[model samples]
Target: MQHRPQNWILILDFGSQYTQLIARRVRELNVYCEIHPFNKDLATFADNPPNGVILSGGPSSVNDENAPNINEDIFNWDVPVLGICYGLQILAHNEISGSVEKADRREFGRSELIVDDNTDLLKEIPEESVVWMSHGDHIKELSSNYEVIAHTDNAHVAAVRHDEKPIYGVQFHPEVVHTVYGGQILQNFVYSICHLKGSWTAKSFIESTIEEIREKVGDDRVICGLSGGVDSTVVATLVHEAIGDQLQCIFVDNGVLRKNEFQDVLDIYEDQLHLPVKGIDASDKFLERLKGVVDPEMKRITIGETFIEVFDEAIAHDDSYKYLAQGTLYPDVIESISFKGPSATIKSHHNVGGLPEEMNLDLIEPVRELFKDEVRNVGRELGIPEHFIKRHPFPGPGLAIRIISDVDRPKLDILREADDIFISELRKNDLYDEVWQALAVLLPVQSVGVMGDERTYEFTIGLRAVTSVDGMTADWAHLPHPFLAHVSNRIINEVRGINRVVYDISSKPPSTIEWE
Candidate 1:
């Protein structure tokens, strides 16, 4: 029941950090799309070409030696090609003898776009609209087939279109949220230019996923590592509906969980949803294995390996559970595997690419294709309570990542108490939904504080709250000053942690949402 797309758009990634943003925008219009490397052989997609092809912005200059390029056959595919930033430069270099010259001044932030052409791509966009620009190269000359459609004050050839072809190019990034009417521009391209219908929906996704699970997992037992998040819970719900009692849910208490989260989630799984749920108390085992480990990636690997080992050992006698169902989302997949195009590893998600090779289990990711927001939509469609579905995303390694330097019981206790207070206060103030993710990171550096009359030294906590549509891009939440003062004072007074609590004001480009 995976709703067959009326038309598909293929986005060739050119190493741009914002490549996924383009795909997200297209998907928002309910059209299907896929991302592939720019260097993929043109022959690979010759027979089955997409309705449109988008060239993503990248870090490399077109004039650089051995720059990334697509085969000349791509232009002959009879598909609309939209080039963005470095993308436009590449097309200029390949299609004509035009060279991408270094700009006198680089455009990094918001810029004014003067749209001279009311063509299909920029049909409804205002003439003097603000756009997000991040590029150092500019196309001064165009081929005979192309002409300037729009320009900024610095970028003369801000946008161009082929005379009689569907090819188009833009210097500014319309995919980012910073660009006004960005989504609407993408909608015009998909609906007006490519004629792609907005047919894909949550109902279609749910039906398709249930059908897929039923077909692929016929008569086989599935062991799912349920984290009680929206991702895993929705996956478990979908699989349970498909395989019924054949699916077994394993909830591991890895010691680094939120305050009182284990019993709360377990009760919901067992009594509420009525799934075959089992709890594993491996806190001591996990803590003992992670002793003295400090590196973030190393901690992730150790925690991931340990989880697999625990699962393998737990199900050693039971040979029926041959498949491992995970709640791996689209952001996790893109971060882990999409960076290097076809096969590359970024940061490993515990349930995704981090699993050891020796584990004899096949993965069944029911919600892997959906983003965080889409997953929440599916969960809502399945009747999950808003309170549960709206919970902020938690890492699989739990609070270990939030504990900056080392992992220990004392640090865990301090972090947990502080985190509980922070989250409880957010919920109390009705600001929980205003942020995508919020956490208290226990910094290794200790600060001096005066309690009553004596001097005390303890750990400092970094409070982080970010707002994002998808986990790909984010901006730090600007909580009220009174809220911050109250939370800081309460944490210093109630939790026996550090004296100072600082808020993270940085956004995603310069800083990640998490301190680690």
Candidate 2:
């Protein structure tokens, strides 16, 4: 793939949990960046060298016998460099004059940062600001040519910079939201030190993506599984533009959709997009197979396998379509392929695994390189309505995961009704766009309640809404009490079989956005 010259940043990942966020932050600045493994060969680096390079945070200790190491010549690549977290420790232990030592007290959360001297990196940052630290090691001895620019309460040498070179390192993570002025620090490095010209935009991405898709799927029929989410909608639109009438979208309603979402989405594809969309009603089939499954992983595997079966069966007699296009994002690919990050397998996405090898379908993932917000931007470029582009994200397995336990029609109905009510209230209060993703999870346990002076045993539901820049990390939405009370009351009173409700207040590091 060809790209514009001198507008990209090369980020080498060292297995940090926040590595993806670094790329997201740079992209948010409208500057292009690419991530490669920490041990990527020097030739790959020489082939398309970026204007600047970034060393990402990692979990491995620099003193470990099998620690990940980079090319020593990267320090002499002439391009500016920024090392973060473990990256800082690596530099201290190797290139610069500093000794890495395990801290007496490990810092795991927010801390106070005091700037000893305002350097180029901390140009406009406040003298006393907050930062997020998650390390058990710190720089004990500073190099002769390096100076401590900033320090936090827990770590004395929180940040350091080279006196002559454009190389800098920070012990704390600036990619996360908990760190104050994190974006500013990155902007200072990207724009001030590297002098990057923010030239990337959604329009240019769409044009290149469309042209690539056109060349890839030349005169061949493509079948895409449309889940009615922004990712798939935008992907379908892009592919449709590339090869008109050659793309046939199949929407499989596994009977686990939002209330009236099946028809609503079908209407959007037929009436609004004016494309060839086939709606497959496989609710009964799915429910029949999911009769007594309780484990979440099993549930996901079942849904994914069943979906592939449905798609294969639908296209068994019709053999024109030869490609299966999915809306698999970059994070999905990273998580599915590697177990090197801080967090382990939180959960398996339906599209991530469990497909039989005999399916014989070539995948044409148009938007796999994008994140959720980027997908929305592409949707806007493709002339999709703002309302559709802004819809909250929904998982591929649908209400099956949200139900949390054995599947049934009554449970699906109750969850769907409650989810619909919760979403309606969010939109009525104009709080939909403020959230990244929101959904109601149906708990397995039931609760006792008194309604109309009668004792009743009903199901309990949990409402989850989170604010996130990308789906990689999330913080629960701090919905107002009045709004929560209203939505809770509506769910308990209007929707039968759901009497009790609660809200999830956990962040992504501790809890995932979904219950299952």
Best by TM-score: 1
- Tens digit of per-residue lDDT, candidate 1, span 40-79: 7667665567888899999888888877876556778787
TM-score for each candidate, following the candidate numbering: 0.93, 0.88
Q: The CA-based lDDT of model 1 is what?
A: 0.85
* Reference-based TM-score, model 2: 0.88
**Each model's number of backbone clashes?**
0, 1
lDDT for 189 in candidate 2 is: 91
At residue 493, candidate 2 shows an lDDT of 95
The C-alpha lDDT values of all candidates are 0.85, 0.85
Candidate 2 lDDT tens digits, 258-370: 89999999999899887689999998998988889888788888888888888889888878778888888776666555534334566667787645556757887876667
Q: What is the lDDT of residue 93 in candidate 2?
A: 85
- Which segments of model 2 are wrong by more than 4 Å? 1-7, 40-47, 71-78, 96-98, 104-134, 143-158, 161-166, 177-180, 317-320, 334-343
Return the clash pairs for model 1, or none.
Answer: none
Evaluate model 2: give its lDDT: 0.85
| TM-score of decoy 1 | 0.93
